[model samples]
Target: MSTIADVARLASVAKATASRALSGKGYVSEETRERVVSAARTIGYVVSPNAASLVTGRTKSVGVIIPYISRWFFAEVLESIEQALLEQGYDMTLYNLPSASPERDRVFEYFLARKRFDGVISVGVELSDDEVDHLHRLRRPLVGIGGAIRGVHTIAIDDVATARLATEHLLSLGHRDILHIGGNQDEQMDFAVHSKRLSGFLAAMHAADLPTNDAFYACELTVPGGYEMGRSVLGDPRRRPTAIFAASDEIAIGLIVAARELGILVPSELSVIGIDGHPYAEMFRLTTLEQHPRRQGRLAVMSLLANLDIPTPEDASESTVLATNLVMRSSTSAPRAPLHHA
Candidate 1:
């Protein structure tokens, strides 16, 4: 019912001037801009993003590529990123990227090549060199979370150091028979986070002159996966560990549940520590290293928005590694007795 032409006529300015004022693109006097804006409000006129982008070369939207949406860490990251973008007057388009499949290929070859959004924020998906080059070809800003990417700004925590700290905490409490329960090294997730964490645990164990034989147990990175593994591992009295360093909070919670079911008193019979500050951690009184995923998400959005208009050098990629905080709880303590092998 209303148009820019009508607003310009009512405000006594040229149509181009009205457009520039509304879009905030070209220089327009404050008095003229206020007059045009008042006229637009009076006429119920709204600027069309499609038309505005034609002149400003910005969609005011960001594309997010993530591997999983249901997982706790990923879900938190996505929510924080969406909120941060909205606060900056930007929209979000989410792409749920699946593991190596035909659909995944199409997402890279077709969907991404379209350049529908102003930039991309990749979460927990390590893009290959070809994929990075493809996005670079469009000259759009790119940011990543969960791990580093070549030629891209990334936000992440030091996985190795965090895991080592968790393990060392148990060792400080006189836990010699410790086990690391985490994702499989062979079926590594994006950036080999599973392997990195396991490596840290092993490194800590070795540093203390402790034997690492049969030290790792591979399982899915979820609560249920941990429950099942915990059931079997804790069921065997001969092979039970004095302490466990879970790769995630969910796994640690599951293990605690399983240990309770088997009449094993936590901290008295077994100790457990994990990464992630999952909401349930406090309820379970589990010791953990909180790697604030939501903070990473917000920082990722900040990095992308700040660099959207700047030209980044090809070799100037920077990785911002955040620190993890250690949370002490009732789940970990000194072993009740000396560790004995069956």
Candidate 2:
């Protein structure tokens, strides 16, 4: 097999310099690093992970914990993280912690305890104090995405603010009878995101002095979930809301589909808005506050890498709040002249 010594000889650099360049550890001049890499590529000199870990005390792999892999947001985030890890010459180990599963506990108590990774990126998975302590004991760099975890580096959009922005948009269009289709607060998996979003919706309504009783509908954060609830909620012409603020673009799309099935004209009869810049949002022309999950994922990986390089326990954990923007589309508009009653 082509060895580091052969690469070093070919690059005309010392073996130690070649090791530093290929391992991405100790600093080497950029020009020298490029030459070493080029020489290594030419010789097909691959660094054995086992040897690298023994020398640097780093596995060069990152652990990623997520709630649901099938969900659109989670999937997008996972893809981004994977791409970033690959670019950084790190492997990724994924742990899917489904709700109410014993496997979830095992992941924290056993799988992560194995010390297989140099760092961890948690997506939409809130770590308990004990779990955090356990990871700290492992001394692995940790970063979170989707919500804040005390003493852990985190990247998240302000869920409440995003939802409030979506709600305020409808309210600005003179929509007094606004209904919110959001995730079930009691059943949420991470950081009470559902509750935070619901709070934002309520805060907006309270600011406008609008009645909020019976204004919220809790459902799954998916298209099918929204479609099922939308059909039932939007079915009643007399009691239907004038505008609907969906917590996610997927839900908004489903609600729109439901409205069409019931022959309800959008914007003119019912306005709709949502969060998340889902791929289908543009196709559906959904008015929404766009929070990029994929970007958030990439940011989390980058943050974790930074933390890994500076392993200082005394350093205060960072909470990065990403920005979101309102994407105006055809789904939302001013309520029609008499506001269709029944």
Candidate 3:
């Protein structure tokens, strides 16, 4: 029920002075600011975010656009972003953009146009030039995670190189009959992550002079997707690969589960390696390349905040690539014997 006017009266200051003191905008003497804040606390007065935004040209809120919420990577990234924003005294509004939905257009053309957020962090959602231009026209600071968009600030790991390293790990362990269980290239979202990862696998195989025929299998980028593909591929001992380089940790976990159900011993009969250091990776004892999505998410927020502070069009758009580390575990080992093919 208390208002800024009441607080101003209680503090014996003009409403404008009270506004300046509370918002930390314009010039207000430190003594006067303390008095105004004391009065506001006494009266339980709260500044209207809308009014403050009008005065400071900032909502103190951010919009996060993401493709999948249920997946491990996206969920971890989102949790990190939310925690970082909260610590920075900001709010997050999430927009889940499912594939093949008109909601993406509505979010860009309507919701974002409302100026409810001061900035945006897009996770794995590629933007068209027009979309990027629209956000730029509104002067909303934008940061992308997972892939690059032309003319947009981005934070991502080297997808191709990471994949190459994962494959190379398997190769170094003397894995000749290797298979890649990765995302479906044709069904990939805007970023073409599936294609990039597959390219990395192929690049490593070619570099090592390994066989490439029938080496790639397309699946959803989830545990269940990997489980299904693993069942089909690892069912027959004669056709089983010596090792599998899964595109993600979730997929690798799924394959491990499937292999267990099929009575196939891992590392002894088949080896598995994956990307991401998912929480369950250690339990599964899966060797992996850890990209640390949570850290990437937090860094994305930091990048957006930095850009907001010094928003020069030229300086705001920079691409940052993070690194990945190889984690050794029980799931990967050299084949027991040379694989023979008829």
lDDT of each: 0.93, 0.90, 0.91
Candidate 2 matches the true fold with a TM-score of 0.91
- Residue 320 alpha-carbon offset, candidate 3, angstroms: 0.6
Worst 10 residues of 2 by lDDT: 309-318
> How many clashing pairs per prediction, in order?
0, 0, 0
Candidate 3, residue 33: how far the Cα is off, in Å: 4.3
Whole-model lDDT for model 2 versus the true structure? 0.90
What are the per-residue Cα lDDT tens digits for candidate 1 across 179-262? 999998889999999999999999999999999999899889788988999999999999999999999999999999999999
**lDDT tens per residue, model 2, 220-304:** 8889988998999999887899899999888999999999999999989999998999999999888989899889989988888
Error of 3 at 273 (Å): 0.5
RMSD of 3: 2.9
Which ranges of candidate 3 are over 4 A from the true structure? Answer: 9-17, 26-35, 99-102, 314-317, 338-342
Question: What residue pairs are clashing in model 3?
Answer: none
